[model samples]
Target: MSISRFDKKIQTPPENPSQNDHSAPEEAAQIGAARVERVIHGGDGLLRLDGKAGFISGVLPGELVSFAVLRDRPRQFEGVLREVLDPSPHRCEPRCPLAGRCGGCDWQYCHSEYQLELKKGIVAENLRRIGKIPLERESIQILAGEPWGYRERVQIHTDHRGRPGFKARRSEEIVLLSNCPVVTEEINRFLEDAASGKILLPPGKRLVLVLADGESPDSRAVIVAPGPQTAQRSLDGLPLSFDPSSFFQANGPLLERLGRELRSRIARDAPRVLVDLYGGAGVLGALAVSGSSAFSGDLLCVEEDRRNARFIEENLLRAGLKEAQIRVVSRSAEKALAVDPVLKNLDPPSSAVILDPPRSGLSATLRRWLKKGPAARLFYVSCNSATLARDLGEILGAYLIQDVTILDFFPQTAHVEVLVELRLKG
Candidate 1:
């Protein structure tokens, strides 16, 4: 389905609902049965209420749902799902008992294959509507893995009673869980042990658990708590050390595949210089420089987080790339890319830049600078499609998208990870 059609049929929530009181009600009231027309980004179902758009959660397209008005505005309304009168054919029994209560997984009720199709539509729709980049559906390759037992890392929150679980949907209240089907068996076992009093956890402290290897839950487990503790892990055969707060890919196997694909792509380009922006722990750079002679010319990693910079240094040294002329700049991508001497000296025709920005996507300063002129080849990794579309729209005039791929890093949820390769226009 075209995004423009959906946009025209459904109105978005007001930027500031308090600006006017045209549809404001003193108290929330029950809205009668509404049929969901389609699913939009962020896993919300779009429907019409009183000739205005209404967004409801825990629903699917073609389902008739009864909802309560949570917030009302002149052109839009927010609702809370009360009951599903008619369900979609793709809907199934959710594995998690707390599916709707916990904010973790939203597409559990929908079939996995259908979820993938919906995600593909979302990516295409976002690119066309927000990015102004129309792409053929067949050109967008979708890569997926086992939908369940794939999460390698998870953060558990503690409640007033010292029980560990995730927060309720859109609220601070904790939903205690004995097991999470989405996480690997190791994490589930750990959760079971913790809840059974076998594992000692202090009250009201968030805990992070990571599996060293993606496949084996028992391989090497790293625990990060609210203290001065460290752990070790290996990605694509490169040893690295990271703290609890460090950023690492949650899916181990898919991360390795992504690394291999990136390395292959970088090797084929034969760039004279490789610059990794928003480099976290320098994993991507390290992977790209592992055995490629083309990247031996120069390698630069720019990161804003001090802790991540230290980890990157330790990782590179551990990888035996000390003589590889690798420079780690501890600064933001916008600042470093703007004035870095190495970037300025690079040969744009034979150079490449790798960008893995945060969910907010590229900053305006960096986007404008890149649009002015950049390396011949650019690789962008984004977790948020909406922001990615917006950024790509601003710079597509200067660069053409050569390839686009979607990685299901997050399954059983509405989130999708996208990787796109762009070539500078002559």
Candidate 2:
């Protein structure tokens, strides 16, 4: 069935209020069986129950499963997997014992190879449905690294007893875990050390661990407490440091690959000026300037957080750009575009802009600006495909989609990072 048909069925109201909300302590009687129609963006399988759309986790497309509805809405019902009557051939046992309970790795039940396929299909569907951009399967590139032990950064939530763990799926309950397999080996070692009293941890509600050098025994990682700390690391031979609170790409190898891709794409565009919006630690800005042989113009990194200015300055300095050539603006993207005189006169043919906004995508003002005054080359790095599609739909009138690449930054989970290249239409 087409996704459009499913959309129509979702709008249909439920026949009875009892079917809409089940507030009883006993919901087992409401269990129903349905074949999963498809997997949606959030990695939930879509199905139909009594002509109403149903969503359940831990199931695959085309699998017949029984589920218990946890929450019911007008159009769709959220459910939990009860029994897999007919499991998919690709199903495999999760590595972690807390697979279904811990919210860290939701797609651990599926094989690594099939996980990429599902993410690609979901991205394509979002582009076609939300962005109105129908892209061929072959044209969408996929780059992935090791499925396990690639994460360089992780957040560990704690309980009242100071036990380190992760939050459970869709609940406030904490799932205590001694170690996570998805993080780097060094991190796991640190966790083991912390658990075994080899290291002491200050009392905090949550802890953020960043592994800069896994091989170094002396100071391989920094265990950032509930305060400000600098996490130092290098990517693709570029020295970098950032506030633990600020954002940084988690996967190492995949991040390096992304750097190479950005450099190559920017070089092809041959932009004289480069602007990095939402520039965290100036990672992308530095990467683009360091490797691009054709890049000659000044580099501008606009970041809203004032605490990141020092890090951005240091990183850009190390990127080989002269001190006079690098400009760091401490302002939001919208404010910078509106107030900064330098950002107002961007040469369409010689300017390149990189957007790495939060999951909400571009601001409304920024979207309007891009649609009217889009640069020659636009590189958008997004973690949410839905927001990316929404932003692209608004700005596609002036920009042509060059290509979209999916990077499996968060393996064993439903999250996928996407990078899109756009060029202004002549």
Candidate 3:
């Protein structure tokens, strides 16, 4: 179990040598070296040192690396990669000079194709290990585009000098940026303009910049900084009104693909009623089932934010769902289900539900309700796989997984968007 033999060029003492001594300070920022056993969900490499499991970012499996322990415990430690004593063959140089410092992207050290492989492996491992759902490696589908310049939305902060930048990794300190490589060209130009004083921005304010359309670089961008002003965008020709602070998908092409996939699945299932949970701007369900000639189902969007009701209604109308029964409930999913008569009387056989909950996944009450087989079909879109696996495991007795697709929404980063289709077990 020792990795000392793997590399002898650099030798360092483990953070803790005594297994039973638990009085060490929590913030033991010590330097140590270990061989990475595997990469985990958040793009950190898992390794063991002195009989204690540890995790360090900016590394890959089989690489012997030195790290600075940010947090040390009796059983485990969290650290940041300091140096690679022995590097993995799949490692590559990051495109951004500030990749290690800026918190914008992780896995920049990993090769592009290897990044996909790591994501697929992480997703499958999470499902198998956490949810007890096992599938062949080839069974999980992956949707990816170019590995760079795909982000349509970016939020930048202004330092005391009004310099726009992103926060450093694991710290509040702003890392000044001359340019960003992962954002769209338009955003990059805008940032450059702002940085060069061509575009004046308030100092010490959070600015949210988003393009009106991802594919059209010529389109105008909507920049908001603490105001009543809002902006409008389109999804598959459906008009969407959103502020810069809106939570729409950042990757445009892959979002369209996700919409198409959901549309095809919902159309094929022919659900008479469609319920969109945690419907942020009513984008997912509205754009998904829109323009489907076979879809004449009633639409219900439940969102806790009442301000989004107008946008939801507007998008639904733009989707040509005027004649169909459409209701926007501005309440949490749990409360909305209890108060709304339609949700209470939903016929599972003729109904479908789209669960795009937050990164925390479904609430316990909602999970319990879903476990009772509330819908015949379920489309669970998740950005966090760990929580997704936990929630899926709770309801597996009632629903069986039919398909799992990994969409590379955030490239050059540890983040991923997953779409899981489930069907009620008869």
Candidate 4:
């Protein structure tokens, strides 16, 4: 016997729905033999639910549990698992106190190895649903890297009256998290120290981006953003900068691997002109080439953030490469590319665009321009595949996807980063 959602039409409760709501009820129940229908990612955002959409948390395939049916949507029912009457063989004890609250990771209750399989399934489903890409289940490889200490950056949220942490799955409520077990001890120490007033954070602040080079033994920079200024630091003799909102990759292990892969591909493309769109600190371009033999026409970086644009220049200089046609366009991606005369005048078939856009995916305007742009190839790297899939669908007729590598950047979780190669279709 289990608490089953009875097609009940749940109404929005009063403004102040006690530390509980109508969906959660008087008691929990023990059920048996619940079938796993399907899994759904709640949009491209952090909310990834399996077993059922709009269903409550803690429900997975092959699990019999007592769940509270919270809210019902047109398509799926949302609920919270009150008790796992029959735990799946893949279920595991979560390691973090903030696991359920932080909402940053949705698959903590699942075993790390099992999570990789789930994510791989998600990718295949997305390709089939969105791109009509027919990939057999056996053809797909579920990829996974190290499960712990993989992230180099952590974005901590702030609150005035509540526990400062990430938002809940589908709501704006901030889940209090003083410590996260999955993060490296280095980061956990910083968070613990911050909790004790060692690091002052703005009250009601939305986020605090912490960045460090895992490879750097003796150096780490603690930079807080949108508030006060922060100090500087370096790693592996590479001049790196971070000031609160400088948009550094949070998962450094995968990023390092991703960077090396980009560098390897650059030799083959041998681009004459390189345009870094949505370029944050110009890391991609910097990693692509060695010291001197740079792009012949122009090496450009475009970013809207003035602070990040400066860091890009500083990074370029530190790499010991001459500023041959290096232009930092201070505008949005499309505006910068469209208005710059030098960028437009590059030699024929000489330009290639490399972009890492914000999670909302590339701007539709930007996608339109790139489809018709003179670039020979486009290397689009994204952490959010949902938006990337959406963007690809938008421009499918314009460009053909050449190659794709789904990176297990955020191991032990459902998040995936992909490096996709695109060439204009005839």
Candidate 5:
């Protein structure tokens, strides 16, 4: 951790005190080496600088490195990794040449096992630091799949030259790529074809291609263009028709496993009513209803987006849950919860609510509502851990964390999906 370990040695002031004042030497020492203590939630290495926490990207834990300050604030500092003088044993060569440049995959430089470990640590840290929930480290289950080529749906940004790729890290400049290592083989092939002028792309439009189940490179893929294009696909055997702009889980291989896990979690509670908030395309609701017979009451799905709400309605009817009571509210979860007198008055012991919020996590209004008590069993699914921890901190008094599972939906990146089962406290 000494500053002298820097690759670029800092120059010392002259021995002759008369020639130069020692005041400048102190400032030079401040720009020296730092040792990364650990990795934080966003895949940044954490270190101490001037007695404050410093976050630097592209370095691993237990590594002595030099960095340039990117941003300075009162309590924390952000830095860009300059050199890893002493590298971590867990660090590996990134498979993709554009690993650092492309904004898609951030953790490609670390081994897959180490990546999982880092994610587990991040979850644990978030729970403890932000949620005030001290979970046993051994109890956190890490579920993983193929570390590469797991993404089924990829949105490729097109530059002015019509090349499809992703944006650079922390930049708006597009990185034109011929192939992405983390996406499915079918998607890579499509990118190659699109890049080679075999397929024509619309100018200035982002292209989203969703591969159907058991689809090959030559098979007809569901293309979601910028305009009015409706795409239909089956996720874990549930027929779903959604607009191209609608949200769906990016990882295809683990969709069935995720669905099964969710269904199992919901069935254990045997709640009478199932309320799915922020339900996109009604996938979770449909899956829960089709798999579990524990719910004899209404299965309500609340979604804010108009297109997604319509798609949820269509998907529910297509799911053929005719015997089961089903309802889709085309409104925000907060709005629906406030306006519906029945939902507002539901008893916690007999009802369950599934919250699959976006990365922003729970809204302030929803957090306040949950603080007042909502359901007996709560299934919270989150893609961002920081916000999840923040939200959990607000309502942990009324709910107990019964189960936690980490789903590696986005491999080769820092992102991971977490599912938490909460039971109402007695």
Candidate 6:
């Protein structure tokens, strides 16, 4: 196997902690020593160490941990657990069977409430530290739904050799996964069958990404990214169809709340317009202002992927909405919102623009458009605060930060999906 580009790092390398090298232990190799730098940079109380990448494992920040070198390269080093000479106050036993091998959730050993705090701190740090933007989050709205079994999405992966399960972190090695502790029971059943090879995956496919709709196992949903088209079912009469490899919010109940969180900021007026940027299957735009009996309005969703745009268009028609009622802008958000004058003319003037950009956040041209556009309100949904904070700083002049809700959407992890509501300040 060839060494990947990320493997090249010049850090002090661990001499022996690996099975590949028998002479390492005796050499007393020199490796980079990074402080368990800070959880959420001190928010989560998580002690993720810095310095040489692969040299630290089984040990967290604030506690001395020597890493077991897995692979050493010029630019980076891969490591595994060696020894934890000391432990942090937040450290606890991990409940999952594959705690060490499974790449799903690393902080499962950490407590639940502590996990939420870590997420909060992570958001605050990304905004204030990385982005260098100030946000008074000490008293912010933090929605912690459930610590366990809250995940509505599950992705099952296997190796080419036909072993059923997920690949170990940073490697393609398959780990048998008959059950997942964090997901609902129904998903577990389906996953168990798939893992046991009872449900044969397409001949060569080795991945299964199951996206559920509601909090329970009974929630109807979609499956993609690995294979299989998606069909969504909801009591609210939502019939969603998605391609095999598109971006869809897997959490159903949380997604509804996410939509409600955005809707709470909008005025309850029919005929209102919305520009759903990166509107995967138009879910966000559909959430912003659904064509319910009590509400009547236009939703213009802009999706770059042609296949996703088709799904959005089909979903709207399935709901008995006029084709004109929902305009699927096949162009990029920037092109749709700016280069194409036709998009700005969708509704009288969009009352709100809801955006869910990729981890990289919004493009520069699109950010500038939102700042100067006619949208009265903006709902910025972000999965990564590092990027969000930076983007927020760029468009601060266009909108004022009215409220930020730190939702524990993804628990047992350092990731926090935040919702920021903004109204035009000037």
Q: What TM-score would each prediction reach against the true structure?
A: 0.88, 0.91, 0.90, 0.79, 0.88, 0.79
- Mind giving the per-residue lDDT tens digits that candidate 1 earns over 218-308? 3766464545445666777776666656777888778777877888888887787778988888777776667555555567889888877
Q: How does candidate 2 fare on TM-score?
A: 0.91
Pairs clashing within candidate 1: none
Tens digits of lDDT, candidate 2, 1-426: 412121121222222211111222342335567888888898888998878898777788878876566677999888666568788998898888887778788888899999998988889889889988888656788989999999888888766656677877666777877789899888888777776667666544778777664346444655564465676678878767777776678897898888888988888868778899888788778877785667778888899887677689899888878888888889999999988877898888888999999989998999999998558989999999999999999899999999899989998988978999998998
What lDDT score goes with residue 57 in model 3?
73
How close to the true structure is residue 72 of candidate 1, measured as C-alpha lDDT? 73
Candidate closest to the true structure, highest lDDT: 3
Model 2 residue runs over 4 Å out of place are: 1-28, 213-219
lDDT of 3 by residue, 1-426 (tens): 437322332244343321111122344346667898888888877998787888777778898877666577989987656568888999887888887678898778788898888888899889889988886657889989878888888888988877789977667888888689888888888888878888778888888777774445436564554554456677677667765565767887788788889999999888989999888878887778788998887999998876666588877877778845688899999999898998899999998999998899888999998999989999999999989999999999999999998989998988977899999999
lDDT of 4 at 48: 19
lDDT of each: 0.77, 0.79, 0.80, 0.62, 0.76, 0.62
lDDT of 3 at 271: 90
Poorest 10 consecutive residues of model 1 by lDDT?
1-10
What local lDDT score does residue 27 receive in model 6, on the 0 to 100 scale?
A: 29
Q: Which pairs of residues clash in candidate 3, taking residues 3 or more apart in a chain or in different chains?
A: none
How displaced is residue 299 in candidate 6, in Å?
A: 1.4
Q: Which sections of candidate 6 miss by over 4 Å?
A: 1-37, 41-86, 202-204, 211-230, 235-237, 268-271, 291-295, 317-323, 342-350
Worst ten-residue run, lDDT, model 3?
Answer: 16-25
- Candidate 2 residue 181 Cα shift, in angstroms, is 1.0
Q: By lDDT, is 5 or 6 better?
A: 5
Candidate 1 RMSD computed on C-alpha atoms after optimal superposition onto the true structure: 6.0
When summed lDDT is taken over every stretch of 10 residues in candidate 5, the lowest stretch is 14-23
Model 5 C-alpha lDDT versus the unseen true structure: 0.76
